[model samples]
Target chain A: MKICVTATAEGLESSVDPHFGRCVYFLIVDDGSMDFESVPNESFSASGGAGIQAAQQVLNKGIDVLITGSLGPNAFPLISSENIEIYECATGSVSEAIASYKNGSLGRIEASNSPGKQGGKQRNGSSQKNN
Target chain B: MKIAIASGKGGTGKTTIAVNLAISLGNAQLLDCDVEEPNCNLFLRHDMEEFEDVTLPVPLVDKEKCDLCGDCANFCQYNAIASLPSGVMVFPKLCHGCGGCALVCPENAITENTRSIGIIERSADWSHVDLWQGLLHIGEPMASPVIHQLQEHISEDNNVAIIDSPPGTACPVIASLSGMDYCILVTEPTPFGLHDLKLAVDVVRQLGIPFGVLINRSDIGDSRVEEYCVSENIPILMKVPNNREIAVLYSKGIPFVTSLPGWNNRFVHMFANICEQLSTRAAE
Candidate 1:
């Protein structure tokens, strides 16, 4: 299964970006091989509908699972519709987040936690909650 | 002549000028184009009659015909449509109602449907002037559709029409200011007011509309606004001092022109001055 992690930078050592829609990079990892490729997020600076665009990009990548800090109103529906499993990881490096997910230690995000258009606000605790 | 009363900054007295000027003119048509929060009706004794619903054409995919071709999703610039392998999802709230998705669907799966975003109302009982306002539904992001509907009610017979425009230089404000013979850019003499007023000026200039400045609360801030106007050669149409009486009257939702009879003549004179400026510009 391929998993995508929102990251602040282009490497596994980079910290996880707390925003799904506006993350600087998306780290797509092949769980079987533990191999990864970092792709820059095109929707990071979109004027509006960043979440929708980001979700669409991830869906197009054939991602089976997503690891992010928070999902917004615009993105949650699109991601959920694709039957892609989502896990919440608000801190730690991209590799650590992937390990937690592999071990089933990370929390599954059941629904959208952040309000739409809160790109500038740092949303914590809610996305990190184990629900 | 049609004049739009617009302020880039809110609470800079766009409605105050619009209501008073329309009342003073007696034969003018007043339109409150701030659909999100229409408030011009508050100061006037008028009976409101519901006009019509403002609707936008959004696409509805016919699943029976749709093969999930992804064509409709690709064509939608607003990202309102998302085509997935399992099913297609349409986010109506994000839709700009451009109808491009329907046009692009080769399978003929997309169909157009009207979604009511707002409504318009006409006021009766305002002795001589006709008052109309647009009300945008809560949570509706677009206001231009309602403003467009309200503009359709502009009285052709009335020589003067005044639009109380929403604050800002965005799409809604552009919708309100479009096709006006003149725009009275009401502003205060502060940094925030000047900054937004410049943005508004850019919009009006781009639209190629003749405009003048009306400085509200003229005495409170610095003289930079006046200096800017003088340098730009933009006419300063009128000035209303920051008076305690006006503030008190505003808090009570009273138009000061009605209580202080002298202000009625002042508003009328301002209107006449605007007319004179328009005529002079036409001659040039």
Candidate 2:
């Protein structure tokens, strides 16, 4: 399965961007081979619907799953509609987040998360309450 | 001739000027374009039994026809539509009801429907002048749409129309001033008043609508407003002194022209002066 992680930079060491739509880059990692490619988010500075536009970009890349800090109201519906599994992470590097996801310790976000929550709130799919 | 009474700042006598001027020009049409807080009807004994609903077209997505191509999402300028991973999302509040999404949908999944934003009410017995007002539903964000509906009342029935424009230099005020023959910028002589007045001046000038200033409460504040008008070569058409009597009458919803003796003639003269200025500019 292809996994996409929202990140601040196009590398494994780059910190995970809490925001999904306005993230600087999407680190697409092959779940089995561990090979990775980076796609720069083109709508990082969009005046409106950055999440909506970004979701379409991810869908075009045929992403199976998305791991990010938070999901906005606008982006949540798009991800859910495309049948993409979503994982929420609190705060960590891309590598750490992927490791947590592989370990089945991350929260699986069943529904849309709140928009751009910075800290002390449920962000990751593993830690997020299913309700 | 359409005259829009606009004030850069709130509580700067826009309604006062509008009601008085409309009454002064007894035969003219009075349109209260201040849909947000329409208080112009307070002074006029106008009936409001007849109301016309003002609506704007909002798009509905047809799931059977939708291929999830995201064409409508990309076409919406207001970012009201989005093709999501789970499904599609539509934020009706963000929609400006432009119907672009419906037009651009490749799959023919989008259909347009009308949503009422406000109502246009008319005075059944407008003997002196035909009075019309736009009343926007509370919490509705789009005032310009309602104002656009109110403007439909304006036609060749009357040579002149007096419009009570909403306060501020935003989209609502622009809607009121659009295609107007003249704008009466009612303002006070305060720092805040002058600051916002400059903003309104910039908007009207940018739109290329000929306008003049009417300094309400002219004697209460400093002379800076007068100086600014003089420097900008903007005509100061009238000066309304801040008086307790005028304020008292306003509280009772009575026009200053009704309470103050001979003020009707003054407003009549002011209207004549505005006509003369407009004609002079036309000739020039």
Candidate 3:
């Protein structure tokens, strides 16, 4: 299975970026061999709809699962179409987040973290300040 | 000729300048394009009449014909259309009404529908000034459509029109200030005011409109704003000083010109000066 983790920096030691759509890097990892591809989020600085754009990019890549902090309302619909599972990873490094996912510690996000059309840090509900 | 009074920051006195100037120069039209929080009507005290409805075309999809190809979703830059496995979803609030989704659909299932977001109100001011203002519905993000509706009320016989533009150098400001003959850039002297004033100046300059600064509450803050204006060679058209009585009267919903005596003539003279400056530039 392919897993996409939001990362703040390049390589495995980078901490998991709390914001999914606007993250600096998306680490697309092959769960079987632990091999990864760092796809820099081109839509990170979009004036609006960055979440949906990022989700589209990951979906096009055939990512089976998304491991990130939270999903925005705009991105929720984009990722949900393919039945791609989304897991909430609120803390730890990208490697640690991947490890937790392997151990079945991360919880599946059924509903979008953001309640409405509002996005990013302003998103309420499942989104936390610490992460 | 149309003149727009715009400021990047709120509370910089756009309405104060607009209302006073309209009263000062008789037989002019005043357009309050600030649909979100229109306050021109507050001082005008005229019984407003709804004239027209402002609507924009948004797309609606026919579910039976749609194959869930997701082409519309890919075409929409705003992500207003989402093609889920179950069906297609359209978020009207997020849609910019660009009409691209309908064009990109191969099945020709998308159809146009008008969504009314705002309306225009008109009121006559004692046969001297005509007031036209746009009022956007609450929770409506798009404001330009209503502003455009208000602009449609401008008639050929109307010689002078003063547009009270909304605050901020965003889409709303651009919508009101676009194609204006001249813009009276209103600003205060404070640091925050000066910072946003520069942004407003940049916008006017980029649009290639002839603009001059009108400093309201000039006596309170430092002289950096004046110095910047002088250095940039942008003329200072008028200076309305900071006065306690003016604020008190304004708070009571009384226009300063109505209570403050000599301000009426001062605004009239300012209007004359604006006409002279604009004509002089045109001649050159």
Candidate 4:
């Protein structure tokens, strides 16, 4: 199984790149039992739409599961629409998050963990199209 | 007149000067454009009276109609739209809500949707000063929408509108200073202060707005800030000395101008001088 782990620091485990405009990180992990190559998340530095880029990277890799400490409103739905699974409340090292995902200890979150229900609106898998 | 109290750097007493100046000037309105971590409300002690949600128009793609031609993705200056072989994706945070993608889409697959990013709260202490604050949601990327909402509270009747801009010279800062009559760049006497001060000066100058500097903690650090001001011919409007008493008062949420006697009068003079300088420049 291939998994993408988003961590605060690089190389400890795959860490979710913190959004430049908003603060938060995601850890995505592949849960399938297949041998998969690990790809480090490319840092997207632009002020707007970093989440989309991150999601696309994960989706392109055919990542099945994401393990992270928190997810924000912007990237939360995009990942879900790609049929990727999200596991929240996993913390500490990236290895630990992966371990939790493998053991089914990581909790599934259908919605975002953003405070004040900020991410709730975007969880419906509707693609936000701003042309 | 719209008077913006801003510093190129943080912790330079921008909020300190803004809160006090609004209070002393009485009948003025204070707009805290520092939406990320708005702290002016902490000092004013005004009960928040009204709250309004702020959102930006992000794109919503109808997957059934999207041909994934990537035209919408190509049209986005920010690369917010991602076109894959099988589907189209929209990254809302990266989307500037320009609506250009929808305009150029041949299939007309893109539609506009609103996503709430923050909230603008309105409150007052009945002391004639009104407080309008923008609070950015924890994970939302765009802050300009909230800043725009806070701007709606700008009272034309108020003789002065003091805007406390965000720290950096980014989109949020630009949104705060847009259409302002005067921008007061606040800074301290330090190397970092000077570096950011120059960056901020470049931004304001590029925007073609009339501006000046107010040096806080003037007694400490190097005299480089003064040198820069002289070299740039930017007027040094006022200087607030670095004092422990002022620091303590600030931590306790007391406006230094009121807690320490005579500071309010200094601000009055400073504001008057700013107005006079602007007028003089206009006449010239």
lDDT of each: 0.86, 0.83, 0.85, 0.75
1 or 3, greater by DockQ: 1
Task: Give lDDT tens digits, candidate 3, residues B1-284.
Answer: 89999987778899999998988887889999988778898988888988888888888999999998999988997767766656777877678889999999999999999898988989943587799999988767678888887887776676689999988787888899987999999999999889888999999999999999999999989999999999999999899999999999888888899888899999988878888988999899
Task: Give the candidate order by descending DockQ.
Answer: 1, 3, 2, 4
Instruction: Kindly report the docking quality category of candidate 4.
Output: incorrect
Candidate 3 deviant stretches above 4 angstroms: A10-12, A30-35, A115-131, B67-71, B82-88, B124-128
Docking quality level of the chain pair in candidate 3:
incorrect
List candidate 1 segments past 4 Å from native. Answer: A118-131
Model 1, range B48-67, lDDT digits (tens) per residue?
A: 98878888887888899999
lDDT minimum window of 10 residues, candidate 1 chain B: B121-130
Mind giving the per-residue lDDT tens digits that candidate 4 earns over B115-232?
A: 8888888884556678899998886656787888898878898879899987777677888889888999989999989988998899899888899899998999999999989998
RMSD of each: 4.9, 7.3, 4.8, 7.9
Clashes of 3: 0
In candidate 2, what are the lDDT values of residues B1-284, reduced to their tens digit? 89999877888888889889888888889999888778888998777754689888888888888888877888886677877544567866567888888888888888988888889899887778788989887656668888988898896778589999887777888889998999999999999889889988998999999999999988987999999999999999999998999999988888889778989999999999999999999999
Model 2, stretches more than 4 Å misplaced?
Answer: A1-51, A54-131, B85-87
Per-candidate clash tally: 0, 19, 0, 28
For lDDT, candidate 2 versus 3, the one ahead is 3
Q: Candidate 1 or 4, higher lDDT?
A: 1
